[model samples]
Target: MNETIRALLSKLGGLPMPVADLADDADLYAAGLSSFASVQLMLGIEEAFDIEFPDNLLNRKSFASVAAIEKTVAIIVDGRKVA
Candidate 1:
């Protein structure tokens, strides 16, 4: 899960921050993520995880950090893959 998050973060910025610099509870919005880019990120996450994010779940809280995203993805994926 961390690896997936790390990969996504890597593609997010050009300055190159270490993955360890991010905490699970960190606010990605404050961490330099632009609002427009965040939506693009949502698309990336959905495509990568093969899951649809709930309409009610579409909020900044869900994209707070890598850990937060992982948790959301886990719930969205619902333990089903190629069944």
Candidate 2:
């Protein structure tokens, strides 16, 4: 599975979702995503990727799109961060 799908699944928490059903350009928030779950999703992503989410990226806009999260993760992966 791609990082974006993985992140989305992790973000889903216990929502019983199907990652493959989501399109790359899918609207995560509108796709049954909740504010509380978003935070958990971020945490799940951080743990899965072993990268901390930057303060500047801690916003609804960042989590609004899977592509955006993938982009942010790419940036995080490109950068050298502490484990």
Candidate 3:
């Protein structure tokens, strides 16, 4: 999942540096993630993981970093399993 998120970010993040160069907790926004790119990254994540991000999770913090995205995606995917 981390690899997938990093791959998606590499393709959609529009960051000045390579996704591989970033730490899991690195600040993506500070690395140059634009608003539009973040939206693109979110859509890419949904498509890749086959999970929909609930409205409550549709905020900056959810996509703040690689770890944040992993946690958010895990929450939605795991919740669907119990449902």
Per-model clash counts, in order, read 0, 0, 0
Q: Is candidate 1 or candidate 2 better by TM-score?
A: 1
lDDT of 3 by residue, 31-69 (tens): 999889999999999999999889999999999999999
Error of 2 at 6 (Å): 3.2
TM-score of 3: 0.98
Tens digit of lDDT per residue, candidate 1, span 1-83?
66776676667532135656877777777777777767777787877777778887788877777778888788777745533
- The segments of candidate 1 whose C-alpha lies over 4 angstroms from its true place after superposition are 13-16, 79-83
Q: What is the lDDT of residue 20 in candidate 1?
A: 67
Better of 2 and 3 by TM-score: 3
- Find the candidate with the highest lDDT and give its number: 3
lDDT of 2 by residue, 1-83 (tens): 26654555654643456656777677777777788888888887887778887888898887776776788777777774443
Poorest stretch of ten by lDDT in candidate 1 = 10-19
